[model samples]
Target: MPQIILGPSQTKKIDGSVKKAGYAFLEKLAADDAVPGLHIEPINGSADPRVRTGRVNDFYRAVLFKVQGQGDEAHYVYLGILPHDDAIAFAKTARLKVNPVNGIAELVKASEPVAAQPAAEAAPEGGHGAGGAAPQPPVHETEPAAEAWSLLETRGVDKEALLDLGIDAALADRAMEATSDDSLIAAVEAAPQWQALALIDLAGGKPVEDVRADLGIDRVELSGDEETDEELLAALQHDAAKLQFAFIEDDEELRKAIEDDDFAAWRVFLHPEQRRYATGGYNGAFRLSGGAGTGKTVVLLHRARLLAKRDPGARILLTTFNKVLADSLRTDLRRLDSSVPIASRLGEPGIYIAGVDSAVHSVIQMAGSEVGAAITEVLGSRSPSIGGRTPASNWLDAAATVPDLPEELRSTTFFQAEYSMVVLPERITTRDEYLRVRRPGRGVALDRRKRQLVWQVVEAYRARASVEGSIDYGELAAVAAAYLEKAGCGVVDHVLVDEGQDLEPAKWQFLRALVPEGPDDLFIAEDSHQRIYGQRVVLGRYGIRIVGRARRLTLNYRTTAENLRYAMAVLAGGEYLDMEGEEEDSALYRSARSGPEPELVPTDSLGDGLSEVAGRVQRWLDDGVAPETIGLLVRDARRAQELVQGLEEHDVPVRVVDAHRDVRPGRPLVMTMHRAKGMEFSRVVLFDVSHDTVPAAYAVDKLTEGDRADALLRERSLLYVAASRARDELVVVWRGQPSELLP
Candidate 1:
């Protein structure tokens, strides 16, 4: 027989006559000490050795082997041994145990019983001749097989555990098969107290009293229904009882009261300073700051309504970042108070709701006809002259020819017509002479040169209009701020500004000009997280004190935890820590329930990508997601055109919501993120969320131009706007490359 060592403590023996080549390999390994721990066991009798002829080839066989020290559980390793010579070399190189020949002997040796006692104890008591009375013939006493079977039977219990406690498996199986809950109870009746507790826990701890009643489980109590294992696990993991809100039973009434034209409800709800704005105190400027889901818009509307109620003749202004939201606010306000004459326009005497451009245009319009005409002319001249198209620069050149204009008038074409210019007199110049010639006087006279100079200066102002028109939203805010500061319009009794975080430093300066020098004159409400557009601007730079009165509405009733998790996953970049007690309820279902999980589809071509997204929209429509509830948000208008064409080809009704369109009831909206702020939908699909798109390549350099803090603030705010738009579901789909913002 050939012997082989398996491990440090095990060995196997095989008949040497099994094969000549196998015996030769074993002899070679034993000589080389490759088969360590090899030991031979003596055989009592010898017989003719039988030659093993057949060999089985199972080369891929790998075994998970375990080795244990005294009293310790085994540790496992996946050991692969091949029969080939190369495998023998590889095993040696890898320092693993190997037996090329008689490998079966090694395996058998490893499996053989370990020695339990010395050979001296192997003989029976009487065989050794020293044991007294030959153990009295071993006193044979046997219970009947039937009696033994009866002793093994159990009434009821955790059959497996009971069997582990020495009950027979057959008895335990029979006990488990018995009918009725009582059978289970009887089986567990003899179980240890700890075993009973384990069984109860496995059965969901039913018939057990809740221990946290004093802390109150009213908000998150389990319904009197059976729960699955997953649900129970979820309950155990979440502190559901901590997240509860005082139910507002009369939401309709509250919304109605907010919309009331009478301003009665607002008086009761608003603080004293807010009441001023709620009651037609629109002359002053203020800012509103608060977390998302709070009633910032509600206060804005109430202020508008109060203005309308206090003085029907006064013009109230309401502006936001997006036109759709402005229109929606208009609709909602109109629905609430039909008596208020609300006009969505600039320079309107009633209530005006618009975007930033509309508001600035209103101020420009008030500058009079000459200023307006010059602005038009300058814009036309400065515009590109491609194909001999009207060049906006021509208008600018014509206006620049004007001279001796006031500095303020020189900056804006709109300043040309209504107001005359007066140079501030120096020590050498007489103030009276300057006032006589340029100050607002009923019968002031001027020479032809001075009058012509004034006209030319007015034209110069028109030239500046083109420059102003080229400025972006942030620049416009800066320009507005400068204008307000130079004009010295003292603050009024009350000033209320909406979407405060979206305002830039310049815009804040302009707002400050509207606030009178008094305590509590300014009221600001904003969510820092919702500053989607104009993130380069900081609310604090606007110079408003954040008092302790700042309120945060943290509850999100609109989105489920799953939907929010997906949204945050796409936007958070591992930086956002979900606050305690902020988990969204997963049970809240959307009206349109069917849709594909938001996908990260890949396509080789842009056209294919567009087609894919368009197909998804069509499928959603077919699944009964109302066309109006579906939105295709792209990064820019150029990309939107392809999606629009695709939708049209599929005969799906779609509307591009830009500055021009009035948001209606049934049309689906397609727009850029810049256009979607302050508006929400039942479903939102943010497309082109790729790195090159979202923080669009152009916005990347903006951080270098603005304060780093302000830029980051604005970027986060923009993402907030995109996130809040989803009332039910938010799907962010991207293709080609993953967004840099993704984890």
Candidate 2:
């Protein structure tokens, strides 16, 4: 077997190429590298002594390292792939070495060889490298090792300690001095992108492990009697957990990635910030929140694997809000570990993976409730709606014939809060029970007479549901939790909830009922900014406490800087809060990649709207973007349907996605922005963003002054979620007058 470690650029290309080409290419490349008899091309003046080249195909060549081994063992490190001449040119000048401090190998570009200074040339007066007017004097060049010493000297930053820590004192100094913060606090805040331990630790007051993990600087201990190629290659390849670079250790792992065309798994690896959450220890309930692409889901997957590994016989329940997301999690889990059995039944032993509804249904069934059919199933599947139309954000659709419904109590938002926050939570059944229930978060106060009328409305809803064999989702969870509280053991040992922000209080209560209160019993990953369901659940209210154990991840792995900025800009100046109502922190939230700024094009005419978008899609296809990598999002189901029809009419194959989509990749995906949560793609086109369609009028029409502001914020959040789904490219098209959301 050939050992090939790819750099970021090469890894990116290979990952993309593999998705397009399949596993046969990788198998061939590995086989080619194993043959020593092949004539590997040598660069004329390589900076890296081991640089070599080999043919990948007729038109392609690979640059690699022919690392000579101690005795008979040897291996190759894949540097990159390029056309023949370019491969040779890259190898000729690429300098390679292990960072003496960080212990990670890096490829450095050699400076162009300088011609010897002309013997007759006078030395500059000011400094050797100075230019322009006559230089004044010779000056000692400052070594980068003193970087920290110069800049941080006045900020109580210790220079000697950094030098001892193997940080380049000069580079550290320069980076710090370059930062705008003169004070230690401001300095750390300004320089989150860099890895300066002592200052960072002091600023954040974080524990040592977290600081090291964030810095990606593990204690590296290198030794004398440097091993030969076999030993070095063996260590580098096998112990990639510590290496800056990594090679494929299990061919099966590589095959699985290729088979699924999941290029994400083929990347260099998870960043340390992500890895820390995956492997961190938590005392009680743990919650992690981050914007999409920050690897919250990745951490949950890895954490599930780690927990399963800790105790071989552990019964873990990996769950989320919906079946599609649950299925996605299950798929990623299997990729992480094939042997770990996936329990088909909710309460079956081993790892029981399920959507919240499935698990709740199982709980109800086991509790002998013999649950009634949901109202939607009887009334014909209805999306959550307000005024019979499903609003893009958090509008509950529940209608029942109540005799003389109080004129003041017809608001769908009012009823949703009454049911989720007041009635079911208090387990109120009768009119008197409902009257006594405290509606804490309900803003509109009702007098005793009005409250009596509200109770009448609540009673009528329950009676109708009971008579029609109709039970809504919240009822299922409420009944199961009510049952779990009085009888039977909890369902699983641990509960891991993804997209926690979408979960309501009832669902949280059910999740709480499913697990015993203990250390690491409940794990939650959520970002309230993505809460399209309009569920603002303060976890602490539901008995799941993660106060001090909460961690925030700010670095985004998906969505480029340009796209991220555009996405974030939509929600900018909007007050988004955590479930707990604290202002969500996005200050450090940043992207690792940069691309062309998002294009917000307004169609000149209504007639050209759909056709213009179709033309843009074709252009992307011509640019070599796979149809599966592209997505189309609209504000509502009406527009989603129209967009899909428009694409098909234009001869563009398009898939209309819902929560239960099968996700056929080669077709452009079109869906309502609401349905695009918890999903991502390489390119996203958001169109039909008209003012009337965006902040659905009826949904916010009944809102109070304070409530209206929150409604608009939620609408912006929906757009933010849709826009952020695009990893590299974002095209937003609007017709007529653009939505007020357009800046």
Candidate 3:
């Protein structure tokens, strides 16, 4: 059978008609290579005769590399879709060959030189190799002297070492011309997988041997002249080569790829760092942390699929902070491979995906009447009917019963935090229990007398809640966890969590109770910089120990370098702690792509800011960017509605996205910054980030001075989350004074 291998060059900007036609071509080619409609033929001026262009339509053509195998099977590497002329031109210059140093397949430009050169003579006299000039720096910076020092040379990594690590001869010369880290990154972006990654590591001050060992490429050896087309075809099977090319096995896989016009091809291109964590085995709880766009969620999804594949009868539960993200995980899991079994519920021989709360609720529902008994065990009282009750309303009413309670302690924020962080996690039911429990992270201090008053308020609150058949989300999780613990915890064999940073202590306890403490039990992916929920949880206290099982990803594959810089700037050097109370290493994060610097537009008023947003979106539309690919994020739902109304006045079509309604087709998205988590867009506008509106007075108004810093950090994280959503372009609009969070 013929093989259809999809390359990473699949254009994200392809139009609907051309994408439809491209899918048809791939489907037909995968079914039978001899299909006449494909129109696969050699380019007339191609140096490598294997390069071919297939007809997607009359005007659009798909470029491919046809390699004949030893038997009847042939391998077709699909480059991308382009216009007829551009396809032919690109096909004529493209060469699919094996890297002589590392034995990995690489697609190179045939027009450029590929011969190896000595370290000292690679870039002679401030010039790159044959047919190439010295690379230039950024526009604002002046060119350095003829003897400008190279970062690689300073670190003892010469051109020969680069070539030995799989870099092409021409690329090694370009790399030797790099004087700064940014310039080195720019030069290596066009290199093959192993070569580019090795260069990136070296630029980051990693030793050459460390880079080789980390990438697992030290054992690979080859010679440039001994390689043949068959050998190059076999090289495509190497792990490094697969980072740029994915071989689609059958019609189903091809169909899945083409169904989503704006397909997520990045999921297929896993870096060595991510591939290891996703496929490797681990003991007990494992946590993967990274900044935005670092592919943490991608790793979690792949890990879930691997666990399912390894033990065919294993019951795996894949969950996140909310249903929308969980739904996304399910969809991506299917797209990752449609053959993976997806279970509708827990305790099944397949992957069960849901929100953490939803999973708890499912367990509660499954337990039925026994829920009351479990609730009784934790609350130290008879279980009342479980119903929705606003925690603020209950806390306020309960405070009224404790006249001697401190005015500061009466605040809803204090009570809510106290209940979630201390009471729920500890299952404190009596005044004695509340008095003995340690409030480690709380900003406020309370003596025995004050604790007694607080206990009175808690008692009153519970009595009222019991009478009204009301229970908060925290209590709900606590009950579910108790029920699971009493029932022996057979709901699932493994639990994989995404966005684990947002979960509170009760939810973590619930998650921990779902699986036994053993190998491959819990896999968590989170980023502290994206924690907008204001929950600073310590996972160790909740039975999820990850002291030595934690790892971090540093490279971002989604946002552009400029956008990532702007987003990280929004954090304003604020310290962000992970689930284990350790500071996150956010400074090491870098992006894989580069684009225009983020735009910050100041306006005189809210109306003017709205108009600016509308104009910018209109320009994006004129430039052929899809409406659904654009996002406008604000601080709250009210601001989102205001922006939607303002956009409508300007005749700009937009939709307000919430947990219930997702991004609509052919409409620009208007959503709160919190709702925009776990989502990405081609372009994003942080709409109306005014001085008074952000930091959102309500979030910090009633907080004590000691707690203000944490509240402010959460606000900064909100802006960071919004800024990182932009994959290509980012625009920040502020009316009057800008938010202090904006750097």
Candidate 4:
């Protein structure tokens, strides 16, 4: 019988003589057939031979061999193992039992009889069965056989001695099992290969490859190039099924709601990407632009609510060109989230709500005395020739100086006479007396002459200031763009811009600067057709890309379909020809419910037209329409006043809503088309929709061909805006000739 090398430490200490002797013993045992029922065969040379040369410290000799018989095969057997002096010392230091000869002899003897057993009788036979069942054939008592093998074999080794060397009974049985049957060790060694196969199975499952692809991992091994469309579709369907709960289907209700211009439903059914645009990140900048009633403001409000909920510590700013619209948005936001603080730069808190001009003013305020001095110097530099004399007590005094003044300057006297003069229009006027009475210490007292001079200077300063800034509102965007260029975009996490399409090239530059390099940081909304101001803006030309994630809301809920149809017909050009009269029925836009059809009333003269429109306005008031809901929009302040007087003569509660005005407490808002850009009302009466009135004479004849077209486009956009302001009804009254936009 051969001795066994039990553990790695004892095997290392064996000397070469001991190892050779062990191997010789194993070979002789195989040749002699020492045990019955065992036909020993020496399959190979010693698997491991530990040889000690010279005086190498802590070294021993041992040999590993394979012993085979007719019944079973022993994968590993050891003989002549010896422990070194260091090995004995290491065991003693660790408080362990150390017996070199007995441990090795016991291991070898234990292995000998096990290798002598018949292959079939050593253990129970089991094969594949249906389901998880085990196939039964024959059974052998493995435990008793293992114990019998251990007891029968001896190489001057003791049982208690082997057990004391940390050789457990179970481990000894496993060793015997491995030595007896090569198949068990082969199965244990094949585990890693089985795990690899399991992974392949998982990867071959439906849609797993797609997920891997999305994650940028190779899925080629999982699915070879069979390219079966059925498999591909099944994979995608399986993936879609996983996200079924997250997706909001385009159902009949959603489709109908969108067609009916119900924003509430649209909000509910918004895609997750759309919701991300509305509320996701807040560290970057954003811009939302779109045609009228396309839910730009709706998205803005949603974004505000989302921001409020996400970052309660950070303040939110909401601004617009139209004061009324700004106020409306502020009101709506407040209604939606009461806990969120709301204020306007143009309104009270001087931070949240602001007009573009007002925001500029705040920046100027930060300029200290320099801005005030510049304003004073500019005001003083205005020519004394401009402005009005006190209301002449006599016609002789008026006639005396009136003739001496240039026609341009004389034509602007009414405007100059006002304390707060408007420089853009020659005829618009304001009262200095009223301003002085209302605001006592706002700034330097302005007589009619000084007011006129200051107005001129301020206009010039604004123009120069805009240019110097390289971007004012239009240039503010440019500055943003420049920053983006320099900073490389990672600085901002989110972006927001109100009136997105109104931004010109420079503004778009600013917008481009705001977009983060990553996909998660950018959100923008714009209405291409609603570029009412005709500003030289280009969103796409400046690298502001709109991918498939962009959404469009086409239905108009703010105005009746009849009006929307007419407006779309005029503005949409070829795209809307077939869509002219096609609109979902709604009570807000129906003529029967809201009012009469949007009228294209024309008269021979402006006075008659004004009177006729006034009569209709009075009739509307008489019919229970609130004065505030009825808006009278004209091309110019001169025409607006004429209509204002006409309505007043009919005892209508008329109030002119202008930026210059102190936002009158409550009156029928009488505004110019430009002033009414962002405002809305239940009923809007667009007064003087004549070709000449809309495309002011200067804009029509003075502009170059391209400029004229741009102006016309702008006028058309303004018309769209005005018509869309009517939530329920719309009326356009023209004198002499209809504008090209009128149906």
Name the regions of candidate 3 deviating beyond 4 angstroms. 10-18, 34-45, 55-61, 117-161, 179-182, 205-210, 258-261
After superposing all C-alphas onto the true structure, candidate 1 shows an RMSD in angstroms of: 30.8
TM-score each candidate. Answer: 0.45, 0.78, 0.92, 0.45
Error (Å) of candidate 2 at residue 122 is: 28
Which regions of candidate 2 are displaced past 4 Å? 1-45, 50-76, 80-85, 110-213, 216-244, 256-268, 335-340, 369-408, 648-653, 704-707
Ranked by TM-score, the better of candidates 1 and 4 is 4
Q: What local lDDT score does residue 560 receive in model 1, on the 0 to 100 scale? A: 40
Per-residue alpha-carbon lDDT of candidate 1 for residues 1-743, written as tens digits (9 for 90 to 100): 11121111111222223223332333432244223332111112211011011111222211222222232232222122234343333222221111111010011111112111112233232121100000111212245444432212232234333323222232233334434222333433332222222232222222112212211112222333322333322332222211110111133332332233222222223322233334433222344443443356776777677666776665556666555666777776775566678765543467767765556545544444334333222222442211112233443354467645433223222221123113211101222433345333112244555556555543353345445444333333333444444555542333445666555444555556544445445555565556554422333434554433343333233444334435445445312211111222221211111122344465655666667767777787777777777767876787677668866776766888877765566767888766776666777877767666656654444222222333344454455566556766666666677566543
Looking at candidate 3, the ten consecutive residues that score lowest on lDDT are 127-136
lDDT on C-alpha atoms for all candidate structures:
0.41, 0.63, 0.81, 0.41
RMSD of each: 30.8, 8.5, 3.1, 33.4
Q: How close is candidate 3 to the true structure, as a TM-score?
A: 0.92
- TM-score winner, 2 or 3: 3
Q: Tell me the tens digit of each residue's lDDT in model 4 across 1-743.
A: 32221121233333345444444433443344345323232222221122111112224423333322232422222222344444333322221111111111111221111111122222222211000111112223355554544221222223222222222322223222332122122222211111111121122231323323222221121133222323322322222111111111223222221222222323433322234456555333344433566556767767766655565543445555445556666665654445565543322321265444444444344444344333323232222221122232222233234333323222222221222212211111123423233322121234556444444533443334333332123323222334345546332333444555553344344435534544434455555555655343334445665443444433343555456656665564321100011222121111111123566677888778768877787787778776777778888888888888887776766888776663454567888877776667777888888877766774445343434565566666667767777776777888787887765
Which ten-residue region of model 4 has the weakest summed lDDT?
Answer: 127-136
Q: Put down candidate 2 lDDT per residue, 561-604, tens digits, no spaces.
A: 67877787787777677866677965546665556778888887
Q: What is the descending lDDT order?
A: 3, 2, 4, 1
* Runs in model 1 lying further than 4 Å from the true structure: 1-295, 306-316, 322-325, 341-493, 535-543, 569-608, 665-667, 701-720
